[model samples]
Target: MRSIISFLTMIMLSGCGDGVTLYPAKGTILLENGNPVTQGTIECESVDNPKKLNASASIQKDGSFELETMGNKGIVAGRHKVTLIGPAGNSDLPLNKQPKPQFNTKYRSYDTSDLTITISPNATNNLNLKVVPAK
Candidate 1:
């Protein structure tokens, strides 16, 4: 009935119009020297809401990655500051330990990383980004 349809529409709109939307994004990560980065996690913090949202993905053996925002499929739609935390080849470390990152510390934070990305809604978001050894 029209009444039922209207109610359902209202429910859907309310959930989706909260000003945050995610978009599928995947890419390959290479080192500043042009080598494929074989292992590590790529994190993209939503410049719009850094304290609460982050999208991350693990680098595959071939260096390709598929990002997920807050465990959902895709990255948050907006500008983001990216960070590479590195060479974790595998998640084999104990909960209390972390693999040593090959890159320097300066590349780990938004303020320090010179890397940034912009993601728009409803677009094919496949993009590649390179990480450099911290200076």
Candidate 2:
């Protein structure tokens, strides 16, 4: 029926939106001691978006990452405030349960991290970020 066909069309187009272009973003995160962060996530909150849309990428063992926004393959173009979440600590637990050391506290929050980057279209957004090691 016509109604059934129309419903199927809408569903197919739901994932498509205002045609906003996203730029590819990739990076590596390092500690001041020149070591790579082994695990966790890196988030980039769009500073110019009222909706506060963010792009995030999981930190790989080599400290490398690639950003994705809302299930897409890239990030929205703009200035972004970067925050890093290191592996959770289980130090209080049994010795075997303790996690590898995390990054400095200041890099865990956007307000205190003091890390920002501008993402531009048609340009390679490869970045290298360094944080202080946990004390």
Candidate 3:
């Protein structure tokens, strides 16, 4: 009976399903203060539709980020947009006429700004972005 229960547990675990894990892309971004900007948000969208394949990640205090996709069960491997939004100050407030806030601006509470990127599928994408103060 113990052996049978063990076998059932194994089967159940194996049938959990496929899942995809995402890691930080290669590259670094330098901020105006000369500090390596590591904390930010990353959004992924489908290349064909430019609306599908939505994914996001928030940089940890240690300057690293990790995001997971639902897996390719329905999403096809291809090019996608990976937008990076960094924290910005109160200057990113929403406009009176704008119903929905824009990228990066939405993170104003945390002081983040938008930084869009393009990435291909089936492989890890390494990206670095440099942000300069608005002169």
Candidate 4:
């Protein structure tokens, strides 16, 4: 009886580690003229419950990016709305006062007004977004 109880306890503890992991979702942004965009900011938000999850990352000089939110500080395992705010190139503006710039590749303003994504526990996931130029 004692051995059986101990075995069951171990099994239960193992199940507690279920969670999602995401990879370095990297991609490039370009202007409508076919020029590579070298500056911007990317952010992730939850679609189901907007206030539940949020994450962001800064674009690199080569137009590549990677974002990670893990160890209980990352997004929960589920769907999310991904949004990108291109760079305005204004260094004097306050952080809170800056507006989200539009992507200039395909002429679209943002990546997804209602983008959906899923996060799996104890795993790594990668995603890419190509933003178009604003009309």
Candidate 2 lDDT by residue in tens digits, 1-135: 999999999976664256667889999999888899889899999998666778998999999999998777788888999998877666579978877556887878899998898898878999899888888
Q: Which numbered prediction scores highest in lDDT against the true structure? A: 2
Q: Which candidate, 2 or 3, would have the higher TM-score against the true structure?
A: 2
Residue-wise C-alpha lDDT for candidate 4, range 112-132, written one tens digit per residue: 354455665555655545556
Q: What would you estimate as the lDDT of candidate 1?
A: 0.76
Please report the candidate that would top TM-score against the real structure. 2
Q: 1-135, model 1: which lDDT tens digit per residue?
A: 999999999976663345667788998877778777777788888787645578899888677999886566787778888888875434686755765665667667778888788887878888788766545
lDDT (CA) for every model shown? 0.76, 0.85, 0.48, 0.56
Q: What is the TM-score of each predicted model, taking all chains together?
A: 0.69, 0.81, 0.42, 0.50
What lDDT does candidate 4 reach at residue 86? 66
* Least accurate 10 contiguous residues by lDDT in model 4: 104-113
Residue 128 local lDDT, model 4: 47
**TM-score (C-alpha) between model 1 and the true structure:** 0.69
